[model samples]
Target: MVDVFLEFMLGPMRAIGDYYFEHQMLFNAIVIGGALYKLASGKKRHEREAENCN
Candidate 1:
């Protein structure tokens, strides 16, 4: 049932999936770094706001 809906786009989806898997390690590292950077910067901004309020 689901295969019927998914069959038409599977080729391109598989290609994209393959490319990501080929560079999966690098892709994961970049994603983790960006997430950590965002977390640190947001914490800093929140700290500054709290300090300003006090």
Candidate 2:
């Protein structure tokens, strides 16, 4: 499912992130920030749809 796909994608991505995180904190911050942004955006969209139904 989606989890499996994310795992596949993030596995290598995490390795790359870790590799770069050692040399550059800003890159790590950006990666983490992007993931947080996506999570928040998805949550906000779901909440908006729920509010519309109510």
Candidate 3:
């Protein structure tokens, strides 16, 4: 029962898992870049709002 399910899923999951580990650094860079972009954009938006109020 469980063995059958595990075996069936493992085929597809194994390929995805392998690619993740292989390009792990690229993944890390993408995550970090997104975070930085969000931070910079938020700061700019705050400044614009403050200018409009004043």
Best-fitting candidate, measured by lDDT?
Answer: 3
Cα lDDT of model 1 by residue, 27-51, tens digit: 9999999999999999999999999
**Where does candidate 1 stray beyond 4 Å?**
1-9
Q: After superposition, how far is residue 40 of candidate 3 from its true place, in Å?
A: 0.7
| Per-residue C-alpha lDDT of model 3 across residues 1-54, encoded as one tens digit per residue | 975676688976877877888999999999999999999999999999999999
**RMSD of each candidate?**
3.5, 11.1, 3.5
lDDT of 2: 0.84
Model 2 lDDT tens row, 1-54: 976776788986776656775878777788899999999999999999999999
What TM-score would every model get versus the actual structure? 0.75, 0.52, 0.75
The lDDT per prediction is 0.88, 0.84, 0.90
Deviation from native of the Cα of residue 27 in model 2, angstroms: 0.8
Candidate 3, residue 38: the lDDT equals 100
Clashing pairs in 1: none
